[model samples]
Target: MITSPIWLPATLFAGAVQAWRTALQKRVSQNLSVNAAGLVRYLYGLPFAFLMLGLYQWAFAPSAFPALGRLFPLFCAAGGLAQIIATNLLLMAFNHRNFVVGTAYSKTEAVQGAILSFLLLGETLSALSWVGILCGVAGVMILSTGGKRMEPADFVRALGKPSALCGIASGLFFALTAIGIRRATQEVATPDHIRAALIVLCCTITMQTVMQGVWLFWREREQVSRIFLTWRSSGQVGFLASLGSACWFTGFATAPVALVRIVGQVEVIFTLAFSHFYLREKMRGSEVSGLLLIAMGVILALAGTMR
Candidate 1:
């Protein structure tokens, strides 16, 4: 099998881009629930994803969506649904923890995605890359636990905390989503695979946006005003978030989904750096060390992937 060299770089760049956007989303979450924030970002992104899909279809192939059986759409939809849950959880995570830690929670996707793809989808990595994956996991562990393990009591306590639960749930949701998307896309034995995949992603996101708006309207009617007000205040952040999602989805499509997920672990470092430098937050020594570990892990993982 031929591997694309550019896929690694694309995945890395996507991680950086997504981290920047996640930071923006965290800022927006200061005034919104995870689902409410999802509504904002997806609504912001809906038109753009559609427009991009249309342009891709028009400029290249009008007959892109073809012969996808029922299962393909289901898997694709599952992927989108996973993202919806993940994004909402992410918002909650931001509320529960610092941006860096919340982001570290999401970086757990690397290990989870790898295992899921291997077991559920029969996809495996090279032995070298497996070592890289281990490094990536160790880095994430450092970021999340800071070389310390929670007491079992503390672990149980975190379960009662909505924010912590949300963040961990969101990371798990996204990891499951990545695995599903990989399965669906891999089965694209038809023409215009990328285009069809793009279409599926767009439609799923649109549905997720609508569903979120409805749910938030019913359950958090009082916060609707705040949601809109927050949107106005952080609308640009939403836009940046959409762009980041676009980059991430594109990167996922560009490479083996597992590889993309692994490289995406680098987001923790990027998010912490962004918070320290841009938000003017002081970085703890632990934070700096965590960043170094994550960076080194990613480099090793990428190196193992070299042909």
Candidate 2:
């Protein structure tokens, strides 16, 4: 049996909320431009992120708020900017002819995250954890293929496509974001992991809001008003995005970044549910097998942590 860890539940919650938030964001995108849709999460979520930080500070009453170290801002900025770019790349992939190829390659984040975490932070995972990561990647790849069987040669060729390259790059940047944030949390001068995470979350969100807001004003000025005009939906997306981010940041603070991301593979399960029920799509046999592999990967990763 897998023992309970705060990171496990935190990551799981983050993954579920993220899958839901993405769906809502897509709906908002239909009404707004891609950049505007991307901005909504940070722009509207800014207030809630602050609210969460304030509430946590009040409730916990840490003897002293953690002081941000010199490296804190650097990590936050790097992580924040990486996330923005990664998101844009993922969105760009959706516009490609073979979008699924991009989506599948993007799912390589778990593996990429592991590698980057090791290189950047010297974090190491167990042998089992590595296996779990590979399994999750394979599962995501299968699902991304929409259940189609691709020969080894075809799979290699697909990776050379423009969409595939975008997806691969997206995953790399996302891995960087995770590594940067995790390192940022470690830079705080406090023993309270949650408080450190909240501080980072608030700072990163504020920066992202400002950065994205400027871009919207300069390039997509027309969509600026539409963002607020569709506040009902945009607000919901913002709230969920903030809530999900809180859990993700907490996970990063409390566990190895790679392990947290490995568990986050569960997000695919939520995505599958949305496709089946919300989109009225049928589940393919390959998707079922992929789901099983993802579940197994999560279990193995979690179990490795326990041991």
Candidate 3:
């Protein structure tokens, strides 16, 4: 798009889109309840998903339902379910803590996803990768700790049941999304990796957006009006999300699954940075350490990928 450098334009747009999108979501979160806002977020995304699917069909010949096979759908389904559930859990976390803290806790996904993949899919990690995983896990733990709770046991129990479990589970689901997307792209994009990745992602995430929308409508029929009223804020949350997702899919298509995911892990840094400067959330001293460890872990994980 630019004479200067193709990658620079794309990279800058990608980062700006991601950061602005997060900032918008944070802004919307201010007015709407987190649960309701998450719902608003989901519902607004359906049109984009469908639009992407349509464009894919128009640009490239439509293949089978998924350019990938049946397994693609299954993996997508599982990933979708995980995404929705984890999202709700994340919203709940936001209600209890600031978005940055909730997000720091959410970084546990890097560790959980790695562990899950190792166990479920036989994905192996090297020493460096293990270190990355530990850093991410340690950061998450530090964020979740009850620093000043009078009844630490009760506090621990509360976190264990919802906060911690939800955060970790969300990470596992996010990992599954990454792995599943890669697998789908591999299957569908046998010859043309980009098309395969894009089409499968469009189909799978479209279905996810639809299912989430349906569930939200069914549950919140009364609030649907107010939610629709808030559609004005959908520009960034919905469109930007779609655009950023497309970039993410394209990035994954171009690189190794592990490497791409490593770069994507930069979302944590982006989220933390954005949360502080844009949202006025202050980072705790411990949080700074936690983020450092997570960043270290991501580096180690990237090293493992190179091997």
Candidate 4:
């Protein structure tokens, strides 16, 4: 059992799992509408989420279930809805730009999350952690660009495009989602971060499933049928998404949202590794440098946490 803070390791594990989930979702996206693809994560994952909650309770708190506070619903709704919007916006971005550029723009979530967390939750990071956050962001930018030589002016111009706007908007909503989940977990009257995380995860996933299911039923009933038709792949997405989300929520419960997100930037690195080994893609020098920078940033952040 995690006797101390599990934020750092939890974030790393979540990042790795999320990378695989994203890859699976990308395949799912090919066969489904963006909204339908996004729904798969919640719709298929609902059962697994409940199963996880039951397992947690049986293992850790068999005697009593923690009572949900009044604020729990509000927090869950905010987080669940924000995440759905963010996912849709990200999927829309695929139509506007290439995957690399879209991902780079969306990666601004770390910086935006820091700002939002401070404004909304009054959370502050140490100077070293701030440096880590910046470094991690830089590393992600480098990886996303893949060492392409675009002029500064061209880069600035690209930001004005619709895809960039969608990416930025998605990042903002993602920041809000993280903040809301953290707030929800905090509102739980339990000291067990695992239990709190599980409760919040179950509630959020249930709400998301219902919201997305209703939309699919009315607007895209065919897509709903297609989702079940592709359950084999969709199930993989759901399982990984559910596990990654549980780790992410647990990390949020243990640390400030901004810090948790900064550390979570390691997801880029994991994606790169998958590309290199599975996709057999070669990494460029800039990509290597970016990885090093991300490592340095994560190390600094971990050191800061030790203090």
Candidate 1 Cα RMSD (Å): 4.0
Please state the error at residue 241 of candidate 2 in Å. 0.5
Model 4 clash pairs are none
Best-matching candidate per TM-score = 2
Model 1 per-residue lDDT tens digits across residues 75-119: 777887787778767766766654445555566677777777678
lDDT of 4: 0.86
Could you give candidate 4's per-residue lDDT for residues 1-307 as a string of tens digits?
1234777788899999999899989899899987798889998898899999998799757748888889999999999999999988887776775555676788888889989998988887888888888888878878778688655566567777878888889889999999999999988888888889989999999999999989988999988889989999999999999999999999988888778887898888899998899999998999999999989888887677666
Q: What are the TM-scores, per candidate, against the unseen true structure?
A: 0.78, 0.95, 0.73, 0.94
Q: How far is candidate 4 from the true structure (C-alpha RMSD, Å)?
A: 2.2
State the lDDT of candidate 2 residue by residue for 48-85, as single tens digits: 99888888887756366777799999999999999999
Model 1 spans with C-alpha error above 4 angstroms: 1-3, 60-67, 88-106, 145-169, 187-197, 225-235, 276-282
On residues 94-190, what C-alpha lDDT tens digit does candidate 3 reach at each position? 5554444454457666565566556665666677767766665665556555233224354345555555555655666666776666556556635
Candidate 2, residue 35: lDDT: 85
lDDT agreement of model 2 with the native: 0.87
TM-score rank order: 2, 4, 1, 3
